[model samples]
Target: MSTAADAPPALREPRLVPLHALAAGIDFGRYFRWRHERDGDPFLVRFPGFGSVVFTGTPEGARELFRAPAELLQPPLPNPIEPMVGPASLILSRGTKHRQDRALLAPAFHRSRISAYGNVIRTAARAELAGERTGAAWRPGTRIDARAAARAITLRVILAAVFGIEESRRRDEYTTATTEFLNSFGGALFLVPALRRNLYGLSGWQRFTAARDRFDELIDGEIRRRRAHGDNGTDILGLLLDTRYDDGSPITECDLREQLRTLLVAGHETTATALVWALYRLHRDPETLARLRAELDTAGPDPDPLDLVKLPNLDAVCQETLRLHPPVPIVLRRLTGDFELRGIRLRAGDTMGVALPLLHADPAVWPEPRRFRPERFLERRYGPFEFAPYGGGHRRCVGATLADYELRIVLATIIGTVRLRLSPRFARGRMPLTVPHNIATGPHAAITFDVLEP
Candidate 1:
């Protein structure tokens, strides 16, 4: 074996040339596809001023990258998102700090705890879709913005499950604050530092900063109220508050608020986008929709939420939806020590981005990858790295179980209680926006539903 000094420098490795800023800014899924076709797997990516980054879309490479020790690899969170997720968010932290925070926060999302929230998710979904058509008949004067409705369901469910806030002035306050914060993130200014100056009255960054302040204030107030009343309820916030580090010290209020922000931002956005895609795909593919409904119907009236969660067809539909278009199609990591990845040397300072879409859509991994085939999931057992809508390894999404649970419950409730038809004008072939990270996988067309039965 060669010594470290004998190895070739990482700079000499093959690389994918940099794309212009304008090209890189739009449609990341398309960009990923183009890069995959051009450079194949483990291609180098470089952004001006951001330095060299490596992007990989192969299963073997992804597995090796994820399994690397934390001492050698670190999570690479972009600077632009730090203000949104906050400084102490787990996504932005690494090494011992990340492990400690993850440990203290893991119990809230434990399988048992997340399963218990199924009813809450169902109730939220039912309430959101109330008065919508149900049955096989087309009801006139019934149109629903699928994305907005999904957002409402997921936002409400997460608010209750994660924050333990029920319907109240405070809940409304949070909903409004979160909406404002999300709306302000649409502009390019958030990423382009030079152009971040105020424009057309209040700039995007200005609005985002202000929204963050309001959201933080509300979260802080809720934390304080819980502390004052000694309300250690079983919700995530309560669990975080009650948890103590191995040193037996409580999490700081600042850190707790940041964690809450991270959860709220990530927990709701991804689930909502997923629901949107699920609904859109179901309506477009009548055969798949019929199969799912048939599976759900076997459960009968007042079926156990847990049973609904386990329905094979329902599970397959959701899985296919995520696999075809994961809400966040890439996960970022930075090298902490010089390493050789699949025979390519990488320096400590390099960033690595895992291309989830390319990985999922690889024909070798999933035959006819572009086809929306839910049966694929039922027919095969994909390894963790093969079908990673939630990523893999230690840095995998902590909220994965909760999000999965919510998606199933909400989708089941919606399909069981509503007869949905795709809007005639629903444009096909439009690409999802890549600028705003949360809604990246959101459908390009405004998917309106005609509710026909109840």
Candidate 2:
């Protein structure tokens, strides 16, 4: 077992590249070989123009590095996100504050609590499908707004999970506003932080980036409403308001808002994208699609969401999807102190990025790495960090179980009842932003389905 006594001495590796010229447009993954070829040092890439150190190693290395997550601070977040996503975000905070913030948020997603959200999740899913059936949303002549479909379903689940009874009243209102706000960003904001100022300012792409002042107004209002009551309610906001430490100090409003905001953005976007991608995949492989449908048929009418954990095929599919298109594919960990990584010495404040998309596709670890096969995940278990789509160690995602729960329930609901397929053209060259680009892209999953009753 690794202990604190371990000293971070200088390390040299078989392949170490020094920071150099060929780092721009780096593929990110396969950086091990690339880095070795370039002399095994850190380098920069130009898509958004950032620096990174690549780590390709065992579970042991991963465990040690992440053991003290606080020690691994990351470079400053790209612009716009820094302010737009909120400064105190669990994803942005450092050291003890990071640990404390994550601690406050963890209980809401603990195993038992996550399981409780399943039934409600299923209910919300059915509502999405109900709307899809009445119109030719994705039929030959009509095109459904897929992201909108995903946003609608996920937002409801989040509201119910976070607000409980409050969801019954304001779900529709929050759905329109929140989805509109998030959908406004899509692929644009992430790829270009500089454009953020242009996009959010007055008359700029409807100029939401400058609308922070307005966002705070709404968020603060929600917090106040939740606090008026207490944790005796079911919403996570309620629980957060009521939660306290042994010292009897409750979390601050700023911290609470950041956590909630993080959940709001990440919680929906990540899961929704994954599921849409999975559906797109299902539409591509008839054999896999047939098998998935067969499995769901066996689950009977109104299947129990928790029961999905036992379905190996379903589990494998989800695993493969995550591996291929992990919602947050790139991880940024700053070397807070001079330390050794995979036998390479690093300086403090230097950042190492784990390109999970590349890692999952690396032929070294995944045989037939490019092929989409869920069985690889079932063949054996990998360490938590080794197979992390939700990250690893102490800073692992608090909502992992909830995310899995939501993905399975929503997927089972649709796959069990609907018949859908993908369009012919968009299937080719559809780049996966998330890892594990499935057989279909989310936008191409514009295919329609006819719901069948069990």
Candidate 3:
């Protein structure tokens, strides 16, 4: 067994390798697979700006990483998403603070709360299908960008269900601000830190900061309004407002802003990307699509969103899509003490992460790993370590429940309502490489579908 004294060798010229490995548009899954083949498990990889990281894709490695003592792990610093999610986000917090915040925020996403949002999810999806965005009804022969449509639906759903923003004018304001803020920080800004400079207000960094300020102003105004009016509504924000720390103090304004930003940014984009992938995969395989549609039909035309969530095939399809294209492909943690993963031992400050693409595609666990097969999920149950699309353990995504509920509900709503096929341009073309989009990764080009009938 390898010990700290016999740590796995680092990839040759770690600096040069990561340039290709982390390149903006490269196929990351292919790169990771190639690396795994060459180096085997528990190999060391180092990104240019980030320090050495030991990555493993085996289920055993994931088990060790996820079960590690919470106090011994923290998000690796100089993280690219820090600027977007903010310093106080649950993603960035560690130790006792993280536990307290998570406990306070967990209830807002409880099954009951999420079940209530089913109607909101369905309403947003149906509105998108009806051409509410462009005001021209979608008709036969109309080609639409699946990602864009899914984004519109997800953004609306998150704002309505999570933030409880029902006023039309305020919703539109948030839509524009959030879209602008996210767009301002392109892949270049995320991948290459040097490109984040503000060159006389012309740089990507400058644009992102400006957009963030506008979005923050809106959030702050809403928070202040709620505080001033003592309006304790039932959405996430209200839950946070009602929460108190063990010390009996309310959450500070800064923490509230960051947490809300985290939910807003992390909540919608990842789910939207997953929805697009689901649509693309479903259309690409007629057999899978037929099966899913058959399952949806069993519940009838006007099935409750919650009922759609319970459909076995629908749940399997969603799980399969997440396995194929996890929105956040890697989960990283910096060590606070000595630890070993898959026999590779490491000391304090050493970093390690679970590479989801490799884990999800392990041939031993998933026969025909590259193939799209939802039946595998229905055939047998997978333990959390074996198949965790939202990551795992204590720090697993706080909004995971809401995201899963939304994905199932929204996907069912669309598949049941629309009769569509992949646009010819993308019908037989090779799958586009997934690229970084602000915080999440998605298909390089828009996945468009031709509306056959509705």
Candidate 4:
């Protein structure tokens, strides 16, 4: 019940960055660096429409913000994401509801059971690679979009392992609807909140709504069918369908649909993007790629999938990829009450976030933070807050275990089998997320790779 008026004047932030710096084509790192250097840690950045936003990268501040009581602080998802996913999503849920939903959903993503899906991940990767264009089939200057290939593999895994939908027709319909729903993200309109309104039947919001409608209908039908027949398998969907509250009552349909969509969206796009960057970076650096293949070759022609994931160097590569280019660069939280962070007072409705990229680039924390050195991970382990590609604390990504398992397995499978090299001519925007060719941005990396041999 405390208000901003109770905060001492000594804790007020001393500087603010103009909102225009966040416009398209701006370098997010440079912008953060500019403000951080001038104002020090826990500085404020003002966006005209969004109001005062506190940005922090130091460990102390990050820990305070991330560990703050749920009643005092809450995750701040953008308006754009809410429309894309749904209002009742666990990602948007807060307080007791958030904790309950997380607990109910925890059984499905348990690490022990997820390892059983390694074959599913491997199978999906191999199938996608089998259909991919290889050196033997390439024309004069053909390059395969690694992002698309990665997306296909990850999407298939989600549909099978998570949804548990073995029916071909229903699966295909669901896939089509899901793809359309994801496509609705990005674009200039996504940033301009006012432009979200439907006008003359032409609007990003309208397109998103249509896609959501299609996806909702397909997923709802699948849910109803599963309910009538009962959950016969151990997929995430089946577990969710059977989840009950402490009162022994079943979860509502609306909550179930939102949770499924949350898993699908979070489970696919970010992991797929990280996969692309891993492949791209390895290919871009031939020595690293050679070393990785050598490590795989160490296990002979046919290594156990479990053994493949355990390879130290391969694990290092995935770790480095995530450290330098985390899919979700920022973890946002909004203050619900007056909060004191590193001697700075943040009022209710003020946004506070840990800028992952900047923290990863901190020299004091990571020596040569800009370099892509996989060995750093092998040398020493980073604390949860120090190397959190998947945001930390209670709200840490629910799919973290599954995602890491998939990334390592997928990388091991693809690199172990296919001979890959970076394409000579590279272009951006191939993927919806605009990760730079040299580094990661947002979720997707838009680099292409040539499949030298199968």
Candidate 5:
């Protein structure tokens, strides 16, 4: 097997690479594309705090990395999002514990369980369309921020699905706390670890910790109430409370908090960003939007969201949007044991991942990749490695099923309900660079759309 010395070519000298790493965090697609074009697949790059990582854009490379033994891979420690997700989060755990946690949480997101929430999804979308938030009333000629609107809709759906918090008062409280917690950790806090330090209660980290504490208090109170009342409902939290390990012990409160937080954070933010991108892309391309609208119109008024999710053109549009702008642009795994890939040997502690942007844009896999074309998805089915908006393998997103279902339902509902066009300023504007927002990357500026009379 090839040794460390035989690793893939480096993007730059070690000293200069942190600069590139910072750039990647801001605009991953552009940076990864530039590096992949120059260094070819499986190039090595080092971050200042994190160690050397080899990223590949080829399907073969993705297949190898994802197929590696589950025992030999784990999410890299001191992960930037560790603060946001907490240590016990399944996203960070490993080995037997990870498997057990995954199994326990899997049922909550099963297709059947998610399908049951179709009404919840559609209700949330309709509420948003009718102006749920301040200044968001959808009158013709009124401009609304797509990202904020999408976030509001998704937040409601996730809150209802996870905690069964359908009461407006309680939902508003959770929304306020959760939004604050998420907003506290901005891109700077994520990209520059130094900014994560608590400085006399004035630092971003301090604000985030304060917000987290409040959010935790709310969650802990809910858990205690549920336990006291022996509440056993079908929501994810209740499901988790009732579940037991092989040893017959229930999950600890600490684990429960982390898991719930993970569900709220990962479940909503990523999907919201994708929704925003879908709306942005569709508005920018009238042809694709018209095609999707036509498909939705055929479904008739007041169609069940379950049926909306099955519409081929709607699915193709969501898939195509994800290809161009995956919320998480790369999937990384730190090696726990030596591994070899594409003739390069990587040692324990080294990182390996697939850069989704490069993989999605590979000319061999996607024709006219830069162009906004939803029909490509209808023409041929792509493998997981070729188009993984959610990462692949055992560590693939637990909420994948629900996210996919929600994206299609919500997108279709909004498009079918009202006529919207990109605000004049954004109508002819170039697509904005994506930057870190909370945990996911999204269009840098607010994407605004004007409600139009049908």
Candidate 6:
């Protein structure tokens, strides 16, 4: 509750980047480089006239920043998602609200639930990858749109985890539409420039909200039908309904909707992105692929399909992919109040976002940051805060572990059954989120692969 004037800015962030470069792309590292590429300083720039500055070094500043004053340095969620995800989302909440939401939500994400969700992950992976046919006519250098393959299974896994839907019953067309709607809302980043004058005058949020609004009728209808049938809510919804706040109130329907929306957006898209990166890296580095294959083959068949989260190498591939191509390449934090550390000054109400793409790519922090080495994570020397596609601290991703489990299971199950290849020239999407060249982003040897019967 401290304002900028009361708390005072004390942290001295080195002037690493100019403010104007933020307009280019969501991930600045993809487009520009600062003077000292090793330090990766310029990549982690601050927006002028913001509540705080971005620190993209080792975990030192992140640790200091997120250490919980309970007042200043609020969670840095984009305002655009508020309408889509509802205020109940863990990502959008700050302070007491965050704590309350997290308490109610954490039970479903506990280790026990993670264990329970494993079978769901495996089944989803198999169901998606099982239908194809392999032929000797297929050449060795063939490639598939692994991103699409990854996204399909990931979507089903999350839905199964949250809604317990089976492959036969899954609504593919509806879900695909839903996914595109949420991802397209990222366009608001472009709208940030059009907001002139008034702070409350939200720019083009109506459009973003509309994208998410398309789902409300469907979601609300489901909730209403479940309530009407006197059906026991079974998925994550069942868990949320069973929880109570410290104030002794059962969560309202609105809250459940927000959390579900949050899970849909964060849970699926992120894992899909990483899986695409994982498959991309695996195809590019055959040694990594072979070793990963050996790990899956050696682990034997896991009964609970979701058991892929435990393989150290499988875990390593996910870790390495996340290190290289994070779904969330930026970490945004708004100042709750004035605060400072590392000789840097921060004021309340200022917004700061870390270029995670650059930090993960930092050579000083990660040796040969560009190399696809899963073993680097095996060292276990790196802190969770140090290497995150997921954000850090109390605001860290609510589904981080589950996302990991989902990614690893998909990687193991698919690779265990079949190999993939694609045409090199068919490479899709020029930027971070790989789109298919034809139906989906694909085809450079890195982006595509052939699915082979192992």
Expressed as tens digits, the lDDT of each residue in 1-454 for candidate 6 is 1223433233323343233334323334444334225344322333432323345445665566556375665655445345456667788777888888888888778877787777777777766655422222223444555655666677777777776666543456447556656654543333242432334536444544555677766667666776677664768866766678998898778877878777876678678777877776777777888888887877776534554577788888888888777665556677766665444555666555555656676666888887889999888667765776777777778788788777877778778877675445433434243221211112223455665544
For 230-301, candidate 1 gives per-residue lDDT tens digits of 987888888888889999999998899999988888889889889988888888788999998888888997
Root-mean-square deviation per candidate: 4.2, 6.1, 2.4, 4.0, 2.1, 5.6
**Which prediction has the highest lDDT against the true structure?**
5
lDDT of 6 at 163: 65
Q: Provide the lowest-lDDT 10-residue window in model 5.
A: 1-10
Candidates sorted by lDDT, best first:
5, 3, 1, 4, 6, 2
Off by over 4 Å in 5: 1-15
Where is model 2 poorest over a 10-residue stretch in terms of lDDT?
432-441
TM-scores for all candidates? 0.91, 0.81, 0.96, 0.89, 0.97, 0.81
Residue 202 local lDDT, model 4: 84
- Candidate 4, residues 244-349, lDDT tens digits: the string is 8888888898988888887887788788888988887786677888889889889888666777778999999999999877877767777788887787766787
What's the lDDT for residue 129 in model 1? 63
Stretches off by above 4 angstroms in model 4 are 1-21, 132-142, 166-168, 427-445
- Please write out the lDDT profile of model 2 over residues 1-454, one tens digit for every residue: 0111222233223222223312321233343346434543232322333333445434445555666456556544442345446778877777777777677788888898888887888877777766742344333333444455776778788877775633444666566556555545544444444545553245433545434444555667788876676334766877887788657898887877767766776777788888877777766667877887788878787667889656777888888888876766555566667766666566675555555655565565778876778778779876665778887766677888988888888888877755554444534455433221111113323433333323
- The number of residue pairs in model 6 that clash at the backbone is 44
lDDT of predicted model 2: 0.61
Clashes of each: 4, 13, 0, 0, 0, 44
Overall local distance difference test of candidate 1 = 0.77
